[model samples]
Target: MIKKFVFTISIPIVLFGCSVTTTPNGKQVDMLPLISDKNRYLIVDDKNLSKAEKLENYSNQLSEFYGKQNSAYIRVLPRPSYQTNDRFTPIPFMVYEIDSNPVKIFENTMFNPNNVRITEYAQHDLRIPIGKHDLIIVNGLGNSRWFTKIDDVNFEKDKKYVIGADVKKGQNAQIFIAEYEIDNRFKVVEPEHFIIKKKIIENIPIGNLKSVKVY
Candidate 1:
């Protein structure tokens, strides 16, 4: 039989000094207003900087804590086809973390583009401890897979970070990255919904600068 478990974490007084608000996925929360006057000048709209800031905040919160936590969300898109007249498909997604590895995370069991649909997707959110690790995502059909490494990462208390996936090669394949907010309180907020659209530029042969990453 499949087993299920539920875990709860209480916010501590020291970490609850500031008021916190929650927003739905894809909704942008204003960070400028949350910072103090002295630090407000440092705020800018650089996407990469914003991501790094959130990651740092999250890392600090969970570095000293115990127990694991998670949030769940889904991404829906029309499956891609390598040839005309191919059938539509589904892509299931999830975001999860294990206690033993701090830097590495995983999104297990995804479906490719040609077979993806809203009903075919599922997700789970989990929180665990920090350590070194490996990240892997296996296609449910067992025909394809992706792997990566997560070095030293401290998932902070209440901050969130975004993870993204990209699949440039092979037909009907896709990659997904999810975002999260790790708060000072050491809790995780589900990430926003972002789609990785495919740009079907004609395949260029050797020595094409633009297609180097794709090759």
Candidate 2:
């Protein structure tokens, strides 16, 4: 009888000892409220999101958090075709400064949360032309799923903006929204719409060199 009791008690302890994985299937990503760090800025225009299902199978709460056809979580379900020929691992977000020589803002991609990158890069303020620029998102499998050219984007100093991706038609395309506001010093500015972690905002660097030019 004592042996039976001991065996039953041990089961619970063994289960508790197991490590919990924060990432789902090694491909899920927790969406950030401000895709860019506080110092860097970009605003996504308001648009009717192309309604379709994407992350429903993964998380219902996260799907509702986005308030549309997107999720607070993203799963990178990469296909073999996308990895063909050893392509640079597909990043879900990319920005290019429009100029005589368009420069890819690699640092921004490095700093943002991604499934492919192991550790995030040290983030700093972005210095772009502050005019028209191309913001692109390629999901898992290296597919260019969303691309838009936004004009007159205001990336002024000392302000933070919230960017969210709207994946539609089963992840065929995406429309991102950027809502602008004054920096609140790590406070949640728009909780009614979404909640952003204070830690993520403060991690933004108030620095020189502007690692990401928000062109």
Candidate 3:
């Protein structure tokens, strides 16, 4: 099961000693990327990681007694009216999370409806609860939306996963799931990066997303 509570952290910018940049899509980037050995995969106390760093480690955090660790992202292929020539562009879809309780992972319609392109697509991924279970999903939008349940999805804490789907134009639109796991190195990106230039005079409240250190 994923952690049940939401974390409301007040980041006072000056804590992270690095410069921050934002992508056109509004994702954060660490100008001075953390230069770790890249071979070390260790987890420290929650207190050790700044709110931003902790959020960055959310997907890959290792533990014997924590929530199931799993991350998944969906891709969609566009349609060119009635043509066999696949219009491999971006299509908006929603990602619905269903366990005991049902929830849509993101408010961004593009991310949920699982949008993507052939040339560039990564930033849009849902870091799901880890463990051995099924990932129940619902894709598409408006009246064309439908349910898709992937059974026995073994989500290992160490191994990352990527799921791709092709949207076929039919009576409506149909999604052909899991075309490939493009990267065993499933796109683990820093969702946000902040560089603290100086200590803030007061506690600051920010929004959008948490700091992502690595991937």
Instruction: Write one digit per residue (lDDT tens) for candidate 1, span 1-215.
Output: 12322222334533343333233333221221232333222222443333334333333333334434442222222223211232333223222123322221211124422322222222222333333333322222122212222333444343233343444666433444334333344212222232233322112221111110100
Better of 1 and 3 by TM-score: 3
How close is every model to the real structure, measured as TM-score?
Answer: 0.27, 0.29, 0.32
Candidate 1 regions off by >4 Å? 1-122, 130-134, 137-142, 166-215
- Predicted structure 1: lDDT: 0.29
Worst 10 residues of 2 by lDDT: 117-126
Candidate 2 local lDDT, 76-168, one digit each (tens): 222223332355543333332222122222222333332122111101112333323333222232322222333334443333344334445
Q: Pick the candidate with the highest lDDT.
A: 3
Q: Per-model C-alpha lDDT, please? A: 0.29, 0.29, 0.32
What's the TM for model 2? Answer: 0.29
Q: What is the lDDT of residue 29 in candidate 3?
A: 34
Question: Runs in model 3 with CA error above 4 Å?
Answer: 1-95, 105-123, 166-215
Model 1 scores a TM of: 0.27
lDDT of 3 by residue, 1-215 (tens): 13332222324333344445454467433321222223122334443444334334432332223345344423222223212214433223322322422322111123233322211222233355544554434332222323444445544443333333323455333333332223233223311121122221111111112222321
Q: lDDT of model 1 at residue 142?
A: 23
